[model samples]
Target: MTKIVPKILEDPFGNLTIENVLEDIVLGSSPYQVTNPHPYKPISMPRGCGFHGNQTKILIMMYSGPGNINQRRHVRQTWRELKDPNVRLVFLLGLLEDAQYVLEDESDQYGDIVQEDFCESHGNKSTKMVMGYNWAVTHCPAADVILILDETLHVVSDIVFEYIRDLVTESPTRLFRNDIRPDQHTGNSYVNLISFDVAKQFHILFPYIKPKDENLNDYVRTVANILSIKHIYDPYLDHENPASFFAFTGQNVSKHLLTYPLNINFRRLVGRKVLYNEDIPHQPINENLPPNIHRPTRCKLLRKGAVQDQFLVVVWSDAFDSEQRSTIREAWGYPNITVKIVFVVGFLDNHQNKIDAESTTYGDILQVSAKTNKFHDTLKTVATFTWIAQNCENTKFVLFLDGNINVNTSMTMTLMKELVKSNDRKVFLGQVNNELEPDRNAKSLTYVSENDYPFDRVPPRMLGLNYILSFDLIKTFDISFPFVKYCSAVDIYIGIVASKLMLTLRNDERFDRTSHSSFLRGIP
Candidate 1:
């Protein structure tokens, strides 16, 4: 490795720049090599568009990292609709050797990716932005304004375009403006809008070096100071209500409950489909949306794991199931058992007081703040798995069971003990179903839309009723679940997650599927 001496390299403008240093490191490195841009007309714009790179008026660039295909797909489905002969959409990614093939596949399908050759790291994010700016400067030179947005944000392009268009028309030479709109002046890197001229100048002064300890906005502000770029606080971008906001983060965006006109003729399109308003409903399904548990206490939230416990048995429950909870506590939830037992619940309307009281009295309820409905069972499991990861630090194994089922805890413990003898970490043991067809009947409650899952057969997954995962397997689920799109069926979702994580789904016949008659007949 060649040593980098800052004092030896100085530019003619008297401002020290890392342009040469970066060029040498990127171009001369073994793993870093600039691949040819995919051969297609309007190389800068996404595929299937007539717009040329230079003629585009507005370009929207979203920054993302490798393996974030789902986030990019969300952008394509929602915001990419704004792409026309003039407007263009593209995603910026850092180069990863392991993900090169995946990136190539996405590029072939979307044709709107800009992958920079660099060592992908959080601190190197500014380098990625600088690379994007340089690309825009070269390819989309005529682009009037560039909206540098984060992948986590949901943007309404029409509102954003109109706002920027009016602003440019009103004041052509202005440099930077806060996207939060009308009155809010505070700027954040989450979303930043800059005119093309300003971007060109900004790139020259600070041509994208790896940022040390500062964030992108701070670095941008430093550049703004160097060039004396005027940053005006404008309210057109920032609206207090996320539904009306021109652009907002995914956290602020609620699950938009769309009301489509009832029509069996979805297979047939008559001319163009009319678009409907996508406003936040006055009454959302459940108040427990996301970022579950605003203020979690030790009672409701599990902190550190018990030092002596080797396994945790979590019963997935809802607030209304007081009777079942009571029976389960008396039968299986024994304090003397070596394995830890707890009930996990998502917030339910009209049952908070009862649930809180039950929790206080029994101290076995693990109340999660995330919204849970019949259709969002996948989300509930996600929250529960995440909680276990955060709180059960010393646990070796975890078993997830439904509240309606009665399990042989002694037998389950024996099974877990035998599995531990093998010294295998990728164990996902339960009653497995390998050949389940996707329900196509639209009227059926179990029906899955083709848009959500087009596959003909479900991957092998364990029945969710009584499944055990080694701590290593649970940790893997926590790491990989966010990257993939999930189905409404919690079992199928778990299957998909396990398949992606390359976990072994072993079927143990002892995990029998007993009917409700077997477990619930004489609970009282």
Candidate 2:
């Protein structure tokens, strides 16, 4: 093993001249090769380079953590068996002191390990992939395409091979060409494949010392734009919901695609679509907005002091009428020093341009990434909680108001202030309902299966129509969001969470369901 140097200025183990390091950086040389003893040595290789004679040979490399010994073993047992002349599996890891012994043992046994000298951290993952690319270019020069993937993925290489085969057959010109005009086909770097020529093109653009907080996908897109290589995005392989535990289940996968490690029983639980349902095509809902309109994210939307020095009021809104939003704004969105209003909305395809224009004008709409309008209601709860936790961390209390509801913002703030001063316990104030039964009807749209909600009796929860979440409660909810099973009913889900946490729900009559007569009709 060779000692890896972090910078050209200093070497930890051995002395290397700054001039030499500069030369390496200029010549597109890999610093990884310095410490690697067997740079091109493989624990396992295809007999006679398997498909070495083929014009478009491929090598699949996975970026793995030094500590994930078990994951490497799992890969060896599953997809590693699929390795052939055209396809090869290599685990790229950094030399960590804690796991060096295990990595060495595993390498000796499996012979598929590609260890580098760089220390691996969450921030340096991009560096590892870059080194992997450099290694592929230098050592595995025969390979035409390199598929970079995370070690956790369970892949079907046959499907990938078939897709690549067809792709190459269709666009043979893309194989040996470098002067093609670049296109804007950005893709997730987590699981993607790039041709050897394309990968080299990106390596040239990537600085030896990466920029601070640089995202891998952004870097890939930048390079992709320069190369004009159209992306071959396989939704079944790349589109994973990192937040959902059941996202990788078999049912979500297509028959003609490669999906992941889901069990038989869990996959059977997913609902199936009828193939020959009667054609009842409904007209697309038009937002009555202009055409070809797209909204670019503005810096002012994320500018500081937007939510500063005030109690953040996050109002949940679906594709409710614009009139409803205006009503709430006119009624409670007054010029107040203590309260700041921000609308949390899900993506509505028909109304996004309208929403974007509204956001640009007001700079108060906090748009979230929800796939469709149908996810508008359920996803808002999660997205709202997340935004508050991240952006409004220093703020006092957060008020979650519905789009259609009428609220006395002044009274709500007064009650919140009183509650905060009076009690030190986490404050969760709303119209508390106790022991509501879970919606168990299978045919119903709002059905709750035993898998989703196992409890017979629902926990006490505050109705989401109007509620105040204190700072502590927001923090807890943020941490719990990843673990909690999501349901469409926001109130019930929060109630179940409250029950789990054993937190007391404070009921306030002032947060009424019906608008008061004094403020009704028009609050003039």
Models, CA RMSD each: 19.9, 19.0
Off by over 4 Å in 1: 1-289, 293-308, 333-337, 372-375, 443-445, 514-524
Judged by lDDT against the true structure, how good is candidate 2? 0.55
Deviation in Å, model 1, residue 253 alpha carbon: 33
Q: Candidate 1, overall lDDT?
A: 0.60
For model 2, residues 104-152, the per-residue Cα lDDT tens digits are 7887787667766767687776777676766666667676677677776
Q: Pick the candidate with the highest lDDT.
A: 1
Q: State each model's CA lDDT, in order.
A: 0.60, 0.55
Tens-digit per-residue lDDT, 273-337, candidate 1: 21232322223222232665322222222344432266677887767899888877667645454
lDDT of 2 at 371: 57
